[model samples]
Target: MLTSVYRLVRPRQFELVFNDITLDKSHVIVHPVRLSICNADQRYYQGLRAENILRKKLPMALIHEAVGRVAFDPTGQFEEGTLVVMIPNTPTEKDDIIAENYLRSSQFRASGFDGFMQEYVSMEPDRLVALPEDVNLSVAAFTEIVSVSYHTIQRFLRFSHSRRDVIGVWGDGNLGYITSLLLKAILPETKVCVFGVNEYKLHDFSFADDVYLISDIPEDFHMDHAFECVGGAASSKAINQIIDYINPEGTISIMGVSEDFAPINTRMILEKGLRLFGSSRSGREDFLGLIKLYNQNPDLINQLEKIVGAEIHVRSIQDITRAFEIDIHKIMGKTIMIWEN
Candidate 1:
């Protein structure tokens, strides 16, 4: 079957391309219903990445976060019309010791191969996870990113010292909000404190135990561990600040993406015996685990709805472009394109 694919030919330019999709017994056809804009997607759409990187990756369909309804299922694993969230991380081989997301051979969607910005996407059964039937889908569209936070927190449970009485999350963005909220729910005993520059954004973290402007954190305040969700130029600042306030033997999970390398205080890291690890994209297990977590706590979904931003219905390339433009100017929250393609 030939289906319409919207690919970014250049910066701020999208063109429709048609490609053949094999309808095989191993694949399930999915109709994308909603897509959430991510910072990584924005980096590509705005041409913020290096020219060489863009040249090698462009003329590519761009979106890794999307929810869809099953149009057809040959193997009967999923019934027709089942709502699901598509997992972007595609692992060619699995390892017992290494998780699928960390494997070097994994091929992620939108980054290189065609993503879900198509009229119909042919997905393997294992690549899709069913969503809650009555849940808010606009919030569900960004499940990929939320699972990322879950993945890191799960790792923290294994890696960090068990004295997680207080945890500090630096970054007032969506990732920080989700990470902190999950911590509050998953580790009910832990006090999740969020630190950020924007007062307005900090106010939105009502679920957090404490929200403080980075500069105003009381001198006596300290946390057992910290997470740096602030990516880009400020990542170093956030990481270093966490190190300064975090107790010894604490873990620092870094989830931010940066084009250029950010310097870290290696001396302080060694001095404090801190464990700093970087977390990138999530895998199938992470998505499955997160959905299970959501099922147990439906209220989490209700809280997630607060972060849903503009929902623009997109049918034409122009509407998609307008959505991206609107996403660029969004002060906070996730921008979703109600896919009508």
Candidate 2:
């Protein structure tokens, strides 16, 4: 079968390429229905990555967050027209102690391998999760993003020694909002405080126990554990604040993606005996857990609806470009691309 793939041929340039797909019985063919533009995609689209890295990674398909329908399934595992969320992390090898997401042999779509920006993507059956018939395709499109928060918090639960009370989240972006919301959903008894620079963005975090501007954080405010969702240039500042406000021996989970190395207060980390870790991408288990969460808490879908900033019906290549252009400027919420072409 020939698949039409949209690739980033060069910085800010995309080209359509055709590739033949030899479908295996172990794989299911998916036709992307809706896609969400991630910040990482924008970094590549805008050429924000280092020149050398860009040169090495160009001509690759550009999206990892997407929901699609099974068009062809040789094994009959999923019915045709079934809505599904596509998992991008492909792990070829596994270890007893290491999770698949952290496996050295894992191949993540849109990072090094071809992504789902194609008319049809042939994927291993395990790489796809069936969505509920009534599931919101727009919200399901970014399940990958929500699953990251699930993965991070699940890891934090294993590593933290604190009471899980008074949790703090740094950043006002979609990540912080989702992380805080997940914390609330998973541990409703715990108090979640959010700190960020943008008050307008913070307003959306009404579910949080409290939302405070980073500049006006109470002097005596402290957290038992913290999550740093702020990335890029402002990451250093957010990390410093998390270290400063977090209690001794607290756990800190870093989820942001930064282009350059960001320094943290090592002295404080050591002095306070804080445990810090980073989480990226996610695995099938996380995706399943997120679905279970949604099943348990049906209101989660309503809460997630608040994060949909813009919806673009992509009918042409120009629409794809326009979605990226609009996404780069969004301060809050996600810009979703409904695959119409």
Candidate 3:
């Protein structure tokens, strides 16, 4: 039997994936689920439109971040009621459409598959994560973004020795704050400095050792390593700035996606002998480590709550456009969709 799955679609554009499939035999057939829409982005939609028209291809699916309950799992690793985060990455679940024929194939369940914006969703048993007893399922929605930071840090830390080293972060958005949180937790002795646009965006970042409003590097401050959490032209500028001021041999880990092309100062990079790296999804080991770290230091999680901007109900999925506006206004730190009982 086929189940109905709702998707956010644009006219001749990409649809969000929310897979609904039948099990051979299962105790529960339908599970009501919730999906967090990462603020509706008109620019993103426009970009998709332009790409489609340019390439003469139809539009694609939208959602890349989400968390949901188990719908069906015959093997019993995931029960119908367990709360979990979906790892949209391919390697963790090889059966994913993207992984089957390499990422070039867009057949994955969430990224390319049907997403979780509907009343019911069908996901593989292994895709479900049993949330810890103490973790609130609602807030757990940020897990995917946190995992992005986790994976980015894992790559940067591979080169560093002690947490006492100082790290620089460019951009003060959700990813930047979370990246700092992960770094501070792992390297308690490390001092972090975050640079961003407005004072309001950087307020929660009072925890940072230093906060810079100006984009240029200060004379006194020198970074052992740097992270570019803002994508686009700003990220490219930050990359060049880091290359100019970063301590010789330091590494740069880029976490955010970019829209416009930015020139990289290859001359400075080669002169400084810097180590630049890029990471996509967090490995299973990275997620497990983050979970362990979160469990040990719940305070970090508490701090993260400060940046959490809004908790609107899932029933308001249609209001995602308004949600996006709220986020852009900086009225909400991290916007989450509440899945009600």
What C-alpha lDDT do the candidate models reach, one value each? 0.93, 0.93, 0.63
- Candidate 1 residue lDDT tens string, 24-85: 99999999999999998999999999999899999999999999999999989888899999
lDDT value, residue 277 of candidate 1: 87
Candidate 1 off by > 4 Å = none
Give model 3 RMSD, 1 decimal.
4.2
Candidate 3 lDDT over 1-341, as tens digits, reads: 45444443553243344444566643333343444445323344444335554343223333445666666667767656676666555443354333222445334433444444445555554445567656765457667677768867776766753433788888888778888878788777888989888677788886788888755557877888888887755888778877776888888887667656678999878888878887655544556667777889888778877866666664443555455445556543666655442
Q: How high is each candidate's TM-score?
A: 0.99, 0.99, 0.82
Clashing pairs in 2: none
Model 1 pairs in collision: none
Model 2 lDDT on a 0 to 1 scale? 0.93
Error of 3 at 272 (Å): 0.9
